[model samples]
Each structure stands twice: as C-alpha cells, then as structure tokens.
Target: MLRLCAASVRLRLGLGLHPSRVSWQRQLGTHGRKESREPLNSPKRAKEFIYRLQAGERSCLLQELQNFESIAIAQETVEPSPPTAAQIKYVLFHNTLPFIGFGFLDNAIMISAGTQIELSIGITLGISTMAAAALGNLVSDLAGLGLAGYVEALASRLGMQVPELTPKQVDMWQTRLSAHTGKAIGVVIGCILGMFPLFFISDDEDKKAKTDKAKPC
Candidate 1:
C-alpha cells in the first residue's frame, strides 16, 4: 500500500499535478459526473476537465522554463523587414565603384594597345582598324581576368563593405534593380573617361597628309 501511494504521487508529479489537489475521489467524480449530472452520459464535462488540466500543466511548465535564464521558448518565425533606401544606396555604391575601375582599365588598355597594334603589325598584316580593335579587346579581356582580384581588393581597401542584409532583402527586386543600375552607370562613366586617349590619336586624313609629304613630288 505504501509503494502504491508513492507510485501515485510520482505519477501526479510527472503529470505536473499537486498531490494535495489530485485524488482518486476526484478522478472517480470526474469519470461519473456526466452521467450523474446530465443523466445522458454526455462526455463534454469530462473532456473539458481533461483539456483544462492539460492547458494548466502546459502553462505551468512554460512558466517554469521562462524563469531559467538559459532556456528560451522558440517563437514563431517573423517576416523579414524590407530594406531601407540607405541600404539600397550602400549596395549601389559598392557595386558601382569596383566596376568603374574595371571599365576604366578595360577600355583604356583596349584603346591604347589597339592603337599601337594598328600602327605596328596591323599595317604589315593589312588588318583593318576594326580588326585591330578586336585584337586589342582580346588583350583587354585577358588582362581583366587577371586584374579582377586586384580591383576587388582595391575597392575593399577603399571601404567597400558587404551590406548587412537578410537573404530575403538581398533577393528583393529593389536590390537587384539598384545593383544592375549601378553597374550600368559605372561602366558608362568609366568608358567615357577611358576615351581620353582619343585626344592624342590623329585622324586618318592627318596620317595620309604626313605620308604624302614624306614621298617625293
């Protein structure tokens, strides 16, 4: 009998019930209350009592857990907030600045090297200016492949940082749009600046004049 009582107390404690509050009499009353009170054997009261007990136990357990600093209840997932304008601008700046260097170097090298190639081997090989330019573009592209790392490193040294953003923010339409726009603007500006070599390049007519003057009359 003592062992049985101890087992009953253990069971009540495990189920988060007070030993003083839970009893065989209460259990029997709960089981037969519907029949005695309603005369129809309705299960509604018994189910309500069981549900209320379960809810109380759950609440008690949650409260106990909340008291401990180490234990935290996992909350429902929250939707990420939309990125702000400043964040978009920051993304644009970093993306744009690196590409500006890339575009400037690419176009400047292409123009300078193409002009030299045209004046040298292009004449002997009878290659058109367009063909010479294409060869120069190939050299530029190769150089770019090697210089890409340097450009990125320079940008980082200049304080370009990766934006602090959630995956959802990074993948948003606004962010993507701003990134592409920055690239386009940067490249355009850089390419335009790279055209400075044109000022030093003489026209085809001037070349012909110099060639004609060199020949005997």
Candidate 2:
C-alpha cells in the first residue's frame, strides 16, 4: 500500500514539475498504435493498404529505371576475362536462382536470392531474364496450384486420409498447403531477377588490360 502511494506521489510530482514530460500514450490519449485503428476484417482498409504498397513499389521501380544513366562503369587490372567462368557462373546462378535450387550458391548469392524477394523488388522489367521472371510471377503461382492436386492424389493413392471426422480438416489443410505452394512459384521467378555485378567489373578490367597492352610503349 505504501509503495503504491509513494509511486503515485512520485508520478504526480514528476508530472507537476515537468508537464511536458507527459507520456506519449497519454499525450495522444490513445491506447493503440496507429495501425491498430484499422480493423483487419475491413476489406476496404486492407485493400487501401495493398493499393498503397503497390503504388509505392511502382514509384520506386520507376525511380530505379530512371537512374540507369547514373550507373557508371569503371575498370581495373584483374584476372579472368569478360564472360569468365566465374562471371558466367555468377550470372547463371544469379539469373536462374541458384540453378533452380540445384546449383551450389556462395554466401552472397544465397543471402540475396529468392523469388519472393525479387518479385517484391518489382523493378527488373528492363532486363530480359528478370523481366520474364517478374512477369511470370502470376502464371507461376497459378501453376503452383497443381501441387495441391498432387497432394490430394498422392494421399488418395496412399490411403493416408484419416477415416475419422476429418473431411473438413483435410480440406482446410489442403487449402493452406496449396496457398503456400502457389507462393513458392513467385519466389522461383524472383530468383531469376537477382544478378551479380562482380563479373561486370572484371569484364571491364579485362577490356582495359587488352587495350593498354596493345598501346605503343
């Protein structure tokens, strides 16, 4: 009781001495974060947020595309020529998402590669390989729905479905599984867009080296 009273007294004294120090929650006179105001079940609010996110993505993609000229190429003395084995491999893996998850990826590639990651970037339409992958995101996701059918077929073939009261449960599980599978398709597409600039630097260096060697001494 005394502790409570003392805490209350201290709080009052602090408020009196520094009125500007009022807690942020109290100042706002609200108990919820800004986002909390939007009820998740409200389709209008949800659609608004999604639209805003898409608009922002489009804006960013436009900005990046506009800055292409700002990209400067520099060359230095280096080993391995243009289209060297490493460059080929890097571009291959970077463009193909670690060779469709079969090829070994270095730390950087692994860290940066992912279809969902690339699709989220949504800024590679200017590049051929990336453009194909980005544009294919929806088609791939739709095709992924086949995985759910495969699961159902496999379960029926194997008689894995429980005999108990589970038709609804199984249906629910299948829906979720199919949704996840569909999303994976987009990730695969995104991986196609991720690329490496390492080879570009080496190729530039190789070109410069050849030119310098050919110059009159």
Candidate 3:
C-alpha cells in the first residue's frame, strides 16, 4: 500500500509541475510574440501619425495656393494695361453702379409729386402725372446735355486741359459727366424746394390735433 501511494503522489507532482494544455492556450494567445514589450496600438504612435497627416494636408494646401497665385500672376500679365485716363473717368463718374444710382435719383426727384399723391386720384391721373414727369425729364436732360457740350467747348477755348480728352470717347464721357452733374444738382434743388408743402402739412396736422384736444370734455 505504501509503494502504490508513493507512485500516485509522484504522478500528481508531475502533473502539477507541467502546464495544462487548455490553460497554456488561453494564456499564450499570441504564441510566439513576447508579451508587454511593444503595443500594437500605442497612443503616442497614433498621435504622431495624426500629426504627420495634418502636416501633409497643410503642405498640400500651401502648394495648391501657390499654384493659384502663379496662375493669377500669369493671367494678369496677359490682361490689358492698368487704369489710366479713361479708367480714371470711369471710376470718378461713369462707374456702373454709381452712374445708375445718380441717374435714378434724378428721375425719382422729378416723379416725386406723382409718387407722393396721398389722395386716391384714380389710376388715370396717376398715370398721366407720371407720363408728364417722364416727358419733362427727357426735355430737361436734352437741354442739360446741350449746355454741357457748350460749356466744354468754352472750357477748351479757355486753354484748359479739357482738350486732353480730345478723343471722341473721352469727350463724350466729359459731356456725359457735365450733363449728369447738372441734372443731379438741379433735381436735388427741386426736391428741396418741393419740401415746402410738407411744412404746411405738418402745421395743419398740429392745428387739427390742438383743436381735437381742446374740445369740451
């Protein structure tokens, strides 16, 4: 019995000394790779990779912008010469937006009466008034343009640098500038004078309000 028991004890000791099959498989999943030495996904490495990617993106953007600048420079070299006399005239008086706006202001001043008719004058009277204003504006513009030409001619005779625009286009531009300036000033003056009626209206409104308030309680 003692000999058999000693054999069984030796077998148990051998089994304990040796690793179990299932436990070894569970613990050594990577098989040959050393554990805890190098990480597959380290935070430091990931941050560095992201930083490199951002740097690459920035570099590409800079390159694209540089290319665009070069293209713009090339296009500029191919374009017409920069602003001079005509361009100066264009900027000062004949710019697309300002020219349209100034002319509209002139027309609006002449048409203000028809626009400000508060009473229901009916459609026909309103249309007639608007037509009269339009016709009047046309006549005024023609006279102003003629005067501008005459003045420009006189200015030339007076030995001014006005002849620098002897070129037909420039002369026409000068004439236009003169006419538009005269018209705009005349309209503004007319509009100011027309405000006289507004003063009377306000006075009448005040008197009416006072009478209403003073009525017997």
Candidate 4:
C-alpha cells in the first residue's frame, strides 16, 4: 500500500500535476480500483489512466487552435466596405491629371510635326495629309512612351496622392468607372486645348500651299 501511494505520487509529479490535485487523484484511484476489483498497485492501469489524461489534454488544445485558425480565416475573407465620396474624388484626380498632360503633349507634338512634314516632304513624296498626320502620330506616340514617366512624376510633385483603400475597394466597379470617366474628361479637355497650334496656321496659307502642290514644276 505504501509503495502504491509512493508510485502514484511519483507518477503525478512526473506528469506535472499540481501537488493538491495529486492527493485528490490518488484518493480517487484508490477507491476506483477497490470498486472495480482491480489491483491497487497495477502499473499497467496507472499508465493507461495517465495516457488517457494526456490524450484528453492534447485534444482540447487542438480544438482551441482550430477555433483560433477558423476565426482568423473568417476575418480575412470578410469583404471590405465601398470607398467613400472623398476616396472616389481622390482617385479621379490622381488618374485625371497625368492623362491630361499626356493628351496635351501628344496632340501638340503631332500637330506641329505634321504641319512641318506636310510642308517639307508631303509635296515631294506626294504624301496625302492623312498619311503625314499618321506619321506625325507615330512620332507623338514614341515621344509619349518616353515622356510617360515624366508626366506621372510631375503629377506626384503637384501633390497627387493615392487614396487609402483596401484591395477589394480598389477593385470595385464604381471606383474603376470613376477613374475611367475622369481620364476621359481630362484627355478630351487637353486635346481641345492642344488645338492652339492651328491658330498659328492661316486658312489662306493652307489654300496657297495646296495650290502650289497642284501646279506642275
């Protein structure tokens, strides 16, 4: 009996059970084995009980961990709210300004270069005004490719900033539509303004140039 109690105490200590709980568990074991007609000092039964307790502890810990993981996944999957009016305005501004500069430069360069090309080479090559314009557009496009970075940099320097938005909010159709609309309006305005070069070329000069091109040398 003394050996059994000592073994029980040692087993509980090894398993890191509190000393107070150990005494209670020891009493329960003693009474349990008496009722079950089992040997009080049976090492096999003691080991099996300890193993059952460890398994219960492991299962409880695993359940808690799974609950925590489920909560985290739920939070991540929740959809973000839509952007506010201020956010939409900011997005429009950020997209519009750079495109305005792009459109202005593109149209201005094309008109200037096309006029010069038509006067210089169109008559010699018998290239139509449309063909000259096309070539000028190509030059404008090439210049745009290089100037794109500068335009964006200038917009940023002028205090254009990206609005604070979640990934879902940024991807929303409303936000995307606002951005496209802003860009369209800006480019249209820029192109209209860029027609300033046409004012420099008189209608009489155009008519005279056409007449000269038609005359035989």
Question: Each candidate's root-mean-square deviation in Å?
Answer: 29.3, 28.6, 39.3, 31.3
Better of 3 and 4 by TM-score: 4
- In order of listing, the candidates' clash counts read 0, 2, 0, 0
What are the per-residue Cα lDDT tens digits for candidate 4 across 1-217?
3333333333232222223322212222311233343433599755544564444444543454475467656657786788999988877876667667766877887898888888879867989999989888767766765665466446656755455656567568878887777777767777777778998978788768878888988
Return the lDDT, model 4, position 186: 66
Task: Give lDDT tens digits, candidate 2, residues 1-217.
Answer: 3333332222222111111112212212221234334433599865653354334444543453354323311212223233334433332332232122211111114323323333343323223335534344434333333432232223234432211212232124433343234334423543444344233335465445545655778
Every model's TM-score: 0.60, 0.20, 0.21, 0.61
Best candidate according to TM-score: 4
Q: Is candidate 2 or candidate 4 better by TM-score?
A: 4
| Candidate 1 per-residue lDDT over residues 35-128, each given as its tens digit | 3343213687545434544444445534533543232222115466778999988878756776677667777888988888877777667678
Off by over 4 Å in 2: 1-53, 72-81, 98-217
Top candidate (lDDT): 4
Ranking by lDDT: 4, 1, 3, 2
lDDT of 4: 0.61
Give one digit per residue, the lDDT tens place, for model 3 in 152-192: 23323333222122223333544456534533453355445
Runs in model 4 lying further than 4 Å from the true structure: 1-79
TM-score, cand. 3 vs. native = 0.21
Q: List the residue pairs that clash in candidate 4.
A: none
> What is the total number of backbone clashes in candidate 2?
2
